[model samples]
Target: MAIAKFAGGWAFNSKAMVADAWHSIADLASDILTLATVSVSLKPPSERFPLGFGKIESLGSLGVSSMLLIGGCYMGWESAITLYAHFDPESAHHILEHIGHGHSHSHSHSAADLGIPSLHAAWLAGGTILIKEWLYHATMKVARERKSSVLASNAVHHRVDSLTGIVTLAAILGANALESAAWLDPVGGLLISIMVINAGFGNTVASLYELVDQSIDKEVKSSIRKQAQKALANIRDGHEAEVRDVSGVKSGQNYLVDLELAVPGSWTIDGVKDLEDTVRTQLAAKVRGVRRVRVRFLSRDAPDDKKYAEFIPGSPGALPEEEGSSKQNDELVDGHSDKHKH
Candidate 1:
């Protein structure tokens, strides 16, 4: 009720009122849909879908944007037709007179016919477009931060809405001012249609890309690398740690990245387990968007003779003099040292 009152108070012209109402309804619907979709996506079974609920949100955004684009174009086309017909000057005059009469009630066609190209409507549409663009930016930021493909796609749809709105508003202004070149209105409408079609195509392309399991952005990869490195640093013998592979699966559209961490040989089972735990814990703490971390520890063993040479000075893969002697003694000090006593 309060919202309606505010909208009514702001709507001075019929065209303005119509445009405002359209935007208000669209915003309300989109907000409700977005919330519902997000809630569903967060549910337990959301991951059951191949593309997850992200695509659903994306589709919803695309639908709303397409509607706005089409409606704007239609309005622009009609205005062009009226302008080309050199719409009855008396109608325009009558509209002005009616407005002058302070009849703040309903506007009749007689008044509408006389209605000059609605600059107020154009401004309102343009402002709405800007708002959509702002929403897109905000949503996209959250998506990127969360690594959510669905939100990103929805943001793209919002971008298209904003672009179409801009084009429509520009056409409206041109048609009103250049009444002589009234064809601009229809041209503007046609351009808006083209933009809508292009946006649809873009959405399809994005969905396909996600479906193909395209590699994530470089920044995301860098973040993963950094986290892996941090995890490696927490291990006692992590000097030879290397990342084998980092792949993510989208179950129901949610991301779950699996990381393979290769470490040096000579780490015992307990040591490996500890390293894995450290890696997982450190990654969870340091990585901003990583929901889970699965660590696969790999050990690379040198040949037995090669291992012995690591401690023998002047031997083919031996350590330096003092260190080599110390390592050899350390290896022999263990209870199992007799097994290699020969």
Candidate 2:
């Protein structure tokens, strides 16, 4: 679509078609980002990135949005200069007199060219409108199902491209039909630039939010919490441990959960291990995109060990035999031994 639009745009003297072609180029860049992120972002967690490589998809989407923003800005600037020239040819010619041939001609020609837009450019624009619109629908459907931010961003780009194609097609047909309405081409270009910029800026902001480890939606988090609470319901009744809190972090398309647990100081290591396994298994199985679950055990009575150790039994018989025999000499040598307590 881009190649055809570019050729037809220049050949038919349609500035709007050329701008739309560049929009198609931006779509290609977005596709590149999508392809690059697919494999890398799905990688399993590593020592350096214990939470996994999901953020790579967000970074790739950011790159796509940045390109669209810069490209749109540049295209808008160029279209603005052309519009200025088209409105007042004499003034624009004098204003760009000192500029180099390469720079001045590019803008002046698009603005001052008297040739009407051709049917070829109109056909190219119309064709791209259909293509981009279809791609937008298809990609957006997959994005929603997979909860993929990058795919969603790219899908938005495709929708913008389709909209720009519509504007380009109308402008081309209008310019061809009305001899004095040549300015419509640059106007269409300007409108498309704004649309592209809006899409880019919005997606860029969203990606940055993800990069900062933004929390997921309240409803989604609540759903996850409900499912987790149910998972713990069975064990909470039998054990001395209870769930203290459940928090989560959003990374790209996935979520990482932190499960804070309050366990009795007498809770054995085996019990804690069982709790960890149960929480992780249930959350990962029941919740969508639960990539990691970290459980923290807080002991209620463990802090009193120091106070208990301070007491020295009066009788050696009160202690375990081997322990009493070994520690008896130390206790006799000094009524208190810091080493023994420690």
Which candidate comes out best when scored by lDDT? Answer: 2
Clashes of 1: 4
The reply for model 2, stretches above 4 Å from the true place, is 94-115, 140-156, 177-179, 234-244, 262-266, 298-342
lDDT of each: 0.56, 0.78
Candidate 1 global CA lDDT score: 0.56
Q: How accurate is candidate 2 locally (lDDT)?
A: 0.78
Task: Give per-residue CA lDDT, model 2, range 174-197, as digits (tens).
Answer: 877886787788888899899889
For model 2, what is the alpha-carbon lDDT of residue 27? 86
- The estimated TM-scores of all candidates read 0.54, 0.75
Off by over 4 Å in 1: 1-32, 44-120, 126-163, 250-253, 302-342
Q: How well does candidate 1 score on lDDT at residue 147?
A: 79
Q: What is the lDDT of residue 335 in candidate 1?
A: 45
